[model samples]
Target: MSLPRIAVDAMGGDEGVRVMVEGAALARRRHDRFKFLLVGDEMLIKAALENHPNLRAASEILHAPETISGEEKPSQALRRAKHTSMGMAVNAVKAGHAGAAVSGGNTGALMAISKLALRTMPGIDRPALAALLPTLGDNDVIMLDLGANTECDARNLVQFAIMGAAYSRIVTDLDSPRVRLLNIGTEENKGTESLRDAANQLKLAAQGLELTFDGFTEADKICRGDVDVVVSDGFSGNIALKAVEGTARFVGDLLKRAFTSSLRSKLGFLVSRPATELLRGHLDPNNHNGAVFLGLNGIVVKSHGSASALGVANAVHVTARLLEENLIERISGDLAKLGGHGLGNGRAAKGAAAKDAAE
Candidate 1:
């Protein structure tokens, strides 16, 4: 099925135009239906496209002289949104020139631009950063609020669960995904009032929403594969994400050291090379490269700044899948099911209160 073209921030990543163009080319090769609006310096994009005639034929270049640097702050980036490649790419989505936008630039900048351009979807108070983490089971687990809102209230958590589950359904193809809140412990009375309240609300609303409300899961169990969605405040979720990444690195480094420790160990490594290769492939970040900003009116996927062509392709694939699955509509449907369940007015009222306080 041919879908709408995806807008790529061609000058966003570490390698800039070459890698981004190559990645989009790679995606086009995998899915012939994929088309692109490559936003960057026209000369650089044209030069890069020389290597991939297929992409050149299928893509259109939008000249964007400015690029958002990795170190640029969101506020500063927002000021130049219309002029920068990152912002233009997002603007393409908002303007209906593209189905979704993908960027490997500054996450904060991309988030800010996307939120400003697309705005939050109806019934969503805040947009959360959600990503798929590799797990021990057949499917990867979805985790949200990675570093979006540092402190989320119970209402935000509930909204995150709704969004995460909608995403999980698209990615995992599960009818009713198992959803859980990340907490200090699994006990009913263990967490903060917000956690307890969100859990209570989820339990009450799960049946109507088509989600399996599994009370709580601790950090260590996030990738165990028992649950499909893990929700948390950005502070805790970001820390847990880093911890998981650190542990993966630690294991890889330890294995490398052990294998090279002695000649005998090197011989053993050769014998176990196939098994280790499989493990390495499974743990590679490239295999899971996209992080979606859920709750936005339009889709915006964040690719790792250092991601390779393969990683960028994966991010594009993710954007395509979400578009095909109608993720925003699904979330809206679920939210509609919660009518009279106390969530209908909570987000709006909360926003109003916050606005009044600011005034």
Candidate 2:
């Protein structure tokens, strides 16, 4: 049997080894292919493992000896801790001992480590972070550039759309899921110079989609599921993602307070328990799992820094599915098609020339 390994950055998160171990244990329960290579302090990992009464034998530990904290600069962290927990995790993915990596650590450090280790896919110049966003409506949207690249060009936006579409297909099972540019307005002239150019490019790349194209949309339309793939620059995308997250937390807390306000309200809460739980599950960041750093040579997932054990476990679960789908190669094929024919009716020929110029 082929062994499917995931390197866990044990020293990377706020929860310490305990939650990391618990997350790994949870993953082991979900998939037999999961072989966790825990990278951190040996003594700490052992203690966490001891807490698990029935720890899986598949788990292995690798000592980091050093760690990168949340506040450190990515460059500084990389220079200081080439052998840190995050660095070791990246090395494991690059060395092919693990099919994927999941880390709840410094976002910038994780991205820097991944780029240095895994590099970018051949046709992809930059690797963008994509977060799965749940909608109040039926289908959820996959939003990209959650903060990988601070500045992106029209070409980059086009790439994000293609990557998002490919991901939506293999994982979300939406063949040609609708693509929409995240804009301040829905008109063709909306957004920055890059976005305006990107919109026109999308028109030329019409057949590139697995589904038909939907136009530009505002942030509010996100919760409405107006489109399947939402493409935006990293700065704006990060702001939107955090805004939604903050709002979700605020509303959730308010609801909790309301539920226990008085005897009458408490009775009302029981009646709404099932629906309320459903809403909570949908809004929970843990259930949303980690964000994917797509367009890489291999899988490198960036779990939330504040993620709990359940969040880590969910990250592992989705990552396993990504491996089963052979996402790297899958993306290559689809993207190669875009490089040649699909988008905007063979705009790839023009796109290729532009890509060459950009280089």
Candidate 3:
């Protein structure tokens, strides 16, 4: 099969065009069939490509004079969608010129523009931010609604579960992934009505699902290697994700202080350098830089705004993999089993009926 070409926003990321271009080169080396449509200022992009001869051979450039700044509001960014590099890259996918679009630009802007240009997939009310997180198991776990919808109903949560499970299957190479809902406790009745309703519905739909619905899982146990996908509302999922990242940085900093506190501690650190290096590799966010906007008509992978060259490459790798696996098709198949009802429609209608009976 012919490889798909990716549209990249060359002016995105904290490190600018150099990192994006170099990353493309690295990805090209690894996946020789991968092609690039680098969109940004042609002169600068060309200069950066001079250092990467291989990438220059496999890539083409599209000039986009403007760039969306990280601090710009989504509304403000949308107005410039026609002229910005991020916007053009996303438009490339909508135009069918590229299979996917990758960017390390403003998260809110990227989400806003992508939805406007590509729209949501059929039967999907909204798209969720699905990201790969490190787990103690051999494979990574997929988490969703990281910051998309702060408030979700029972049906919305159920949709996230389905989307997340589909993503897990592709990334982890698993036949049947084990999914769990993130909650304060694992008991059946511990959460709100929405959580309870979603859980019941998942159980009802489990017979038709290709994945195993493992009920509820606590936040502390998400990385225990037992769960393959963790679903939650954007409010809670975002908090949990941030807390985990902060804790990792905290521990690393504390260890650095202890190791340098004295000669004895420094000697001990030297003795355990190999083990620490392995741990660092596992915890490095760069190894897992891509966060996909699932449920969109076209694939859009969001890279960390502060990503390095290798980090951007990893994001590109994720985009290619999703396209190869036909992620959107897989999600559509699972959604079809839920009937033609839109997200949350069943539960909403039921609630209205109950109110009528009470009145």
Listed in order, each prediction's TM-score against the native is 0.95, 0.91, 0.94
Task: Please list the C-alpha lDDT of all candidates, in the order they appear.
Answer: 0.90, 0.81, 0.88
Global CA lDDT computed for model 3: 0.88
Expressed as tens digits, the lDDT of each residue in 57-84 for candidate 2 is 7778888899899999988987865679
Among all windows of 10 consecutive residues in model 3, the one with the lowest summed lDDT is 340-349
Which has the higher lDDT value, candidate number 1 or candidate number 2? Answer: 1
Better of 1 and 3 by lDDT: 1
Candidate 3: the clashing residue pairs are none
True-vs-predicted CA distance for residue 7, candidate 1, Å: 0.2
Off by over 4 Å in 3: 340-359
TM-score of 1: 0.95
**Count of backbone collisions in candidate 1:** 0
What tens-digit string does per-residue lDDT give for candidate 3 at 139-243?
888888899888777767788888898899998888889988889899998987777777877877766776889999998987778899999988888988888
* Residue range 210-284, candidate 1, lDDT tens digits: 789999999999999999999999989999998999999998999999999999999999999999999998999
Tell me the number of clashing residue pairs for each predicted model: 0, 6, 0
Give the poorly placed runs of model 1, Cα more than 4 Å off.
Answer: 340-359
Candidate 3 clash total? 0
The numbered model that scores best in lDDT is: 1
